[model samples]
Target: MTVEEIHGVRVLTVPEAGPAIRGGADALDLVAASFEQQAEFVVVPVGRLDPEFFTLSNGLAGEFLQKLVNYRLRVAIVGDISAHVAASNALRDFVRESNRRGQNWFLATPAELSDRLAGEVEAGPEA
Candidate 1:
């Protein structure tokens, strides 16, 4: 819904009120929108995603994220998923590894995401 540049990272921030994103189709739709908007990243609120997305066993997260990566678009799931992480060690690991990879990030807040992008900018495009 809203597209803007944050710390030099052009991002398409999905609106909380939009249609429910259930699977890869929805992910692809977002990818298309990102391209149209010339955004390199798609930042979706954690609440906008399905409950299964938080459960690594469900594979929805993998399926959905793969689509975005395939299109060369990075994704950041922004918001608190602390409860979800607390429940599953695999998810905890997933989130931690995702954060390090820099392609897919599980950030606690938009402010954190902004800080992340700011760091990336300072690191330069070669990073």
Candidate 2:
């Protein structure tokens, strides 16, 4: 794991080589990792998450995301999730709405995350 600040958004990035995250327990560990760094956001590579993570019907995403929301911690799942998105309209809609909300984002790259934070800063406190 690595922690860095991009455009004043403190991000805790999970290592690409890290173990696959399977359930809420594993997801919570990632959130917990942020506390030590005082990071406001977490960047987890798509490869780290289990296949079930993308299946909204399975409820893992909701469970894990709810935990992050409860902690007021933002997160970006960085990578190509096109396959998963294509597989289910619910997931597609979920990702779309998540990106719109700004609390949780489905990003294609870390640079996109920096750009999103920049926009949020410019949008001010209402954002």
Candidate 3:
């Protein structure tokens, strides 16, 4: 992982290729990894997550997101998840709501994440 500070948001960029993150424990490991790097936010490429991560029945997505929330750290799933979203309306709604809440986001590129961070900075304390 490589850590970069974008608009004062410390972002840990996970490698595009690695062991798939499959469950809550794996999600916790990611938080630990981010803490070790002293990063406040993690940017995980979608390819690194298990296929089941996008499937709500597996509960992996909720478990993982809850872990991040409990830790008070933000995360952005970075990459294309259109296929998964297309396959499940529930997943699409989840993504939409998550984005609306602003604690986490599903972004397609590093540029989008940078834009989010920048926007948050511009929004000031209320953000």
User: Tens-digit lDDT track for model 1 on 44-111?
Assistant: 99889988888888889999999999999999998889999999999999999999998899998899
Residues 38-115, candidate 2: write the lDDT tens digits: 999988899999998998888988888888888899989999999999999999999999998978899999889889
Candidate 2: where is the Cα deviation over 4 Å?
Answer: none
C-alpha lDDT score of every prediction, in listed order:
0.91, 0.89, 0.90
Error of 1 at 122 (Å): 0.7
Query: How many residue pairs of model 1 clash at the backbone?
Result: 0
lDDT of 1: 0.91
| Residue 52 lDDT, candidate 1, scale 0-100 | 84
Q: Tens digits of per-residue lDDT for model 3 on 1-127?
A: 8999999988888899889988789878889988899889988899999999999988999998889888888989999999999999999999999998877899999899999889989999797
Residue 92 lDDT in candidate 2: 96
Q: Model 1, stretches more than 4 Å misplaced? A: none
Lowest summed-lDDT stretch of 10 residues in model 3? 21-30
Each prediction's RMSD to truth: 1.0, 1.0, 0.9
How far residue 10's Cα lies from its native spot in candidate 1, in Å, is 1.3
Sorted by lDDT, highest first, which candidate order results? 1, 3, 2
Best by TM-score: 3
Clashing pairs in 2: none
